[model samples]
Target: MLTPSLMHHLSIIPDFRQAWKIKHQLSDILFLTVRAVICGAEGWEEIEDFGHEKLGFLRQYGDFESGVPSHDTLARVMALINAKQLQTAFADWMKACHDATDGAIVAIDGKTLRGSYCRGKDKAAIHMVSAFSTANGVVMGQIKTDEKSNEITAIPELLKLLDLYGCLVTIDAMGCQKKIAHQIRRQGADYLLSVKDNQPKLADAFEAAFPMKVIANYAGDAYTTVEKNRGREESRYHVVSDVSHEFQGLICEWPDLKTVGAVVSFRQEGDEPPDEAVVRYYISFAELTAEQMAKAVRQHWHVENKLHWFLDVAMREDACRIRRGRAAENLGRVHHIALNYLKGETRFKGGIRRKQKKAALSEEYLADVLAV
Candidate 1:
């Protein structure tokens, strides 16, 4: 069969340039950009350079009749493409490429692209909220928000775009809103949302239900996990219980609030005076055992460790300064697309940066990743 359509999915993005004025094809531009980014191009100039170097390989997938577009043309095309359309198209591609979402832990979180801010326009750096399927190590979907405080609103929008039929969605304290919980249910998914000062009464209820005495004495369902890495040791103590009826009056506002839990983490790093202990609280629609709760909560950080960290470290995403029009957001999408491809291309047996270096040096390697 012909290489399946990464081309067809991206081709759906409407070309904004005047039809007759177009020199390089939109499909070519889009394909070239994604491939370039995947192979370690960090900016429009680098993308343009990659096109010049790999024009032969790119031609197999796209019509580069007029050859490569200039850096300016690439920037103009990407900066003007409708971001929402791009998001939907990529999401559809991700679904087709992987079938790992059933019963997965979908973690939703936000990260700020620190370098995208523009003092000239006085616009803040774009904050993107991403939904990641931890089990498969792939980004499911993402949406851009104007600020961190807007995560409460962004999570619902991102949720609407995901296929989470049997997944357990997990969010941090910022996503504890009732509307978010209800929306997750609407998406046919359960949720484990963190509780903090954002919801004072709910926080108070969890605090009361899981007192020191109760955590020390209660012999009910509980689980503990230990970790040791690089002279550092940590233990996670997970304890869960039914959302008591006594808190019904307080937590009634939260939709389908069925379980409440706590994770108390103790850590010691090479006898560095043993850092302060940390405690976190949570509420979930799913009635979870301490073990289930522990797994879901632990998996929730995949978004941070796998997606966001790789973007910042491997892709140097925060260092990119493409802050014009929709360029920053669109470039962010490019990174997500490339990251998914790199993560899914498991035969490479190396991390993202190494894969990028190898892909840059070898056309066969790039072809293998793009083909899959």
Candidate 2:
């Protein structure tokens, strides 16, 4: 089997410590940290313990020279490492592992690490914006922001780093800016940006085109889908309308605007009548069919349902309270790397939690996960 590319990427991160003062290899500590995080390590102490327990297994892939470092040493060393370089290294590694298929939706969203907040200090929790490739079922890259409102500035920076050619990128209302649209198109990718009251004229145009007060009489393509989940049934009414000549002048500010899409969902609870219909509008550069638009909209949630939700629940990301320096940010990337490795391992027919348990208990299983 070929060696995992992640191992090679770890070497590029610079070591700030003096050469003679360094005890554990920077690469070895990183290698141990990522591997341990994959096998259920939550914090620095757990990672250090994992390193000591799995020293023999880790030695096969990395040289654990001078034995495992203490939890304090690991935390202090990692906190000093540049978080941006760590993000880049893992992104390059993921690029090698997966291919970008056509028509795939690369969903961009932000999540805050709630537990990273320091009560006594002036430190606020850190928020992260991430690009998740639904086709690859793994995070392509992530950028840290100071707060939720910073997503506007962070989205463009994150888009500049990704390989989005021949793909459809989707972002929520927060990312629906003309500059963001231009950048996505400039990268040779199409964008499906949500339209909300933030853009008053654009929202009005969509509302007039697909008015909820009037009966459905759109001239373009349409598709419907129904399903039940979490004790509720939802019927989605999807419509893709061509940009008529009247609104061409209104939407000319947006780059390469092609179609306007809407998903009106009528939902009902158990043994009750359907509640108020929720309608959402989107502007897309791709001339997507109604079915394609529906799939794109649904897949946009993959970043949340698959990435953020899993991190908080399966990985206990919100539960970790280590906020000294950039330790939380560096370890956050390790969580993504570990998730990619676990997700890439398809041979085991089990969930993430089960796979983590298996890897923790068995050396062979851990090796198999790393071999990915």
Candidate 3:
């Protein structure tokens, strides 16, 4: 994984001549935004301030032009730089991060930046669809929506840009469309999607097909699993049972949904287990035993804990208000880049903002972090 510290060791610029000749080389743009991210910059002006203040150190680092690119220069270059090109380069970075694991769980999710909106715009939101690798702790790439379009369209475009072979792609209810399922399968990947109201017919059918009553009485494929943890006083017991296709209604319309499964889990804390248990239904491509399927389902949450939750709560991404021109899209990419760096760091566990603050305070760490 391209940890912030380790990535600092790599070269950020590949074409020196091209980098030098450009109005603003890619490295200056990349490093500048990285520095701003490290320093808690939320807008182009803040980034400009950061760059002007750190000119000496930045010049020594050797990625900028004659001096640092002015705030206007930075804004213009970012506006002109094709979002697709930057996205491609970002994908390369993500590939490096995912290379550590033979096959990682890459979650595709969307976030709407509520603060990024023009004064009179109709939707008043910028939708960003991103792919995050749980195994490597890196974000693959992100694309922006001009209006309030469905993720169905955005997810496919994002998927088409990525290499999905050997990795399991996880999507929420919004991404449970048939085309997406087919797309994942076509890309040599397996999908584990949540059953919900978005695909109401299919979800209802799957539920009816694998009802609790059917599971309670039937003698079918069954597995019992247990998990124990001491630090948080967590204990879990799961019973995974599968049902045949006999009771399936609309589930039959879904491609390759052979077995309908249910996992009933009970958790305990403090001194006793909770009286109310949690039951989850899953549709799987892999014919995993109930135990294995349960594990994969649980691991899927890492995307929320490791990616979205971190970006929103730790990085304060949704709270940002950089909505002019391509600033919304450009800054979103910067957030992912910083997130990739932080996710790679093994030493920090406090949160992204704090870790970034520490990096800004220590020149050695800052240089060590953004070197590459």
* Best candidate (score: lDDT): 2
Stretches of candidate 1 exceeding 4 Å from the true structure: 1-3, 147-149
- lDDT of each residue in 28-92, candidate 3, tens digit only: 66677776786677767888888888878777644566666777777766665566666666766
Winner by TM-score = 2
| RMSD over all Cα atoms, model 1 | 1.8
Q: In lDDT terms, how accurate is model 3?
A: 0.68
Writing each residue's lDDT as its tens digit, candidate 1 over 1-372 gives: 013556677778999889999999887888889899999999999999999998888888778999999999999989999999998887787776666555689889999999998888888999998988898788888999855458877888888877888889999999888888888888888889998998888878877788877886778889999999999999988998887865788555877878888888989988787677788998888989999999999999878889999999999999999988899999999899898888878887899999999999999998888877
Which of candidates 2 and 3 is the stronger one according to lDDT? 2
Model 1 residue pairs with clashes? none
Clash count, one per candidate: 0, 0, 1
Task: After superposing candidate 2 on the true structure, give the runs of residues whose Cα lies further than 4 Å from its correct spot.
Answer: 1-4, 147-149, 213-215
